[model samples]
Target: MEIGNLNDYFKFFVALVAVVNPVGAIPVFINLTANQGIKARNATASIAALSVGIILMVVLFTGEAILRFFGISVGSFRVGGGILILLMAIAMLNAKMSNIRQTKEEELDSTERDSVAVVPLATPLLAGPGAISAVILHAQRHDSTLHYLYLSLAVVALTAITGLLLFLAPLISQWLGKTGINIVTRLMGLVMAAMGVEFIAHGLKQLFPILGAS
Candidate 1:
């Protein structure tokens, strides 16, 4: 078996980390499962992570094909997707949920449901448009089977990390406190903004090859 490339894996992790921002989701996770017992909370965390991992894995492998079916070019996708990620980053920095990722409707809906792991937690919160775009972009950049496997591994690893954090949500909240979480959120936002800019730059280079020559 081919060894996984650290550099590629790092890139995947960075992009995924910035987009997923599992740390940023702690408050919401805590709120969503506030009434649940420890076992229920742990189960919720696992399901959310598993669901998100599945969503990302599917997109990572099939996003290119989906774009092709829609006749969307990588350059176009990068520019558009970058914009989405940038907006999310801005919201993250502001310590608010982006409407694009999670809306008031979803929040309200979550309160009514006994199980929110698959809906708001996994679907939009963890694997929403921002995360989806980042994964597709990652797939576009690293296409080899080995690299793809690495990408898949990164998704699993990140999701597992996310789950662990959620499982320990109460402790994390207590240790980090609200102020600490906000600080970390902003820092992650900065990293995400950087990723967005890189995406736009790369896409522009493709859309206008002349720029690369100059």
Candidate 2:
């Protein structure tokens, strides 16, 4: 909590950023909102960003309660989340995981017009199961309320920044070019995969007493 000890908070911020990878998500955002008008696209981005912030806050505050309600331990959630992240990393590495086509199908419905941000963007794309699980695990790790608040704020700020960058994704995509984007995506996938392995290892260590003892 002291000024000198803020390093931990900063470290947490970096970890959250790496896990969320807002910059890495920009291309997907561009692809998803390609069909919408400028105004609609901007609105969707704003809503999606706000939705992600809200979802993170919920996980930070009530994540334990939610997990308890479901009779799921934090270790269990991490193991599951680790697997999900691994799958996502594979998709990122392969570059064929965009849900734009599926989103387009859903958008074809009249009632789906207002749900764009909440549906594909906010849910699976931005604050999907992997993100939710990550935040919940983070909350469980941080016992201090102040640290939790700081970490949550950092996550929200990072998410908002990512969303803002995503709103200008056309320019970013042009600047990055296909090759640059592919390189960045591959790098992010590698990092994500490593994180997934760490999560799995942590969960297994917790679940297996012998592993923890050794």
Candidate 3:
């Protein structure tokens, strides 16, 4: 089941959106940059988005080799990553941020730091574990360089959309308010949960071919 078809590529994009949930991260971006000037905030947004794109692209291309170095199969990693993403989705569904993405310590640390565009905002916050895992798992579905290129493009598109959202964070925050943001988060959470389950199911089937036969 190579990611040669448009549907598969679209699913990859959707999964990235569901897990990334840029809309859900708007409030965080706003709060993190609240003390900064408009220009500074915009700069932060641009840096964060660019950082996310770079991180995901690197992971997508090098992830399999990293797993091989650790002697971990894609199927095993999928199950582990699926559980992590599922936990995140549950937190999102409850309209709360997951500690898995950023712990209380990290949040506090960000507040004390002068620059947070790359650390909390970009790394663990935007391009965190679930996002990286999603890229790796999706990359495993490819059999050719063309498919890898398509996946890389998808990553670019995801970051582009996220960057745009962060750039409009203030306006989006004013428009959505807390309640609207929470509603959107919950909806995205539902989608994330579904994707998490799909990852786990596929991983299980791969690890145990008998399950696929059944």
Which candidate comes out best when scored by TM-score? 3
- Cα lDDT, all candidates: 0.89, 0.72, 0.92
Residue lDDT tens for model 1, 1-214? 4544698679769779878988889999999988999999999999999999999999998999999999999999999998998998899889878899888987898899988999989989989999999999878875678878888889989988988888888999999999999998898888889889888988999999998899
Which candidate should be chosen as best, given lDDT against the real structure? 3
Error of 3 at 23 (Å): 1.1
TM-score of each: 0.95, 0.83, 0.97
How many steric overlaps does candidate 2 have?
0
lDDT tens per residue, model 2, 25-77: 67667766768899988888888888888877888889889989999987888
Runs in model 1 deviating more than 4 A are: 1-5
Give the range of the ten consecutive residues with the poorest summed lDDT in model 1.
1-10
Candidate 1, after superposition: displacement of residue 132 in Å?
0.6
RMSD of each: 1.9, 3.5, 1.3
Query: What is the C-alpha lDDT profile of model 3 across 1-214, one tens digit per residue?
Result: 3447988899889889888889999988988898999999999999999999999999988999999999999889989989999999999999999999999998898898899999999989889999999999988887688899899889999989999999999999999999999999999899889989989999999899899998
Order by TM-score, highest first: 3, 1, 2
Off by over 4 Å in 3: 1-3
C-alpha lDDT of residue 4 in model 1:
47
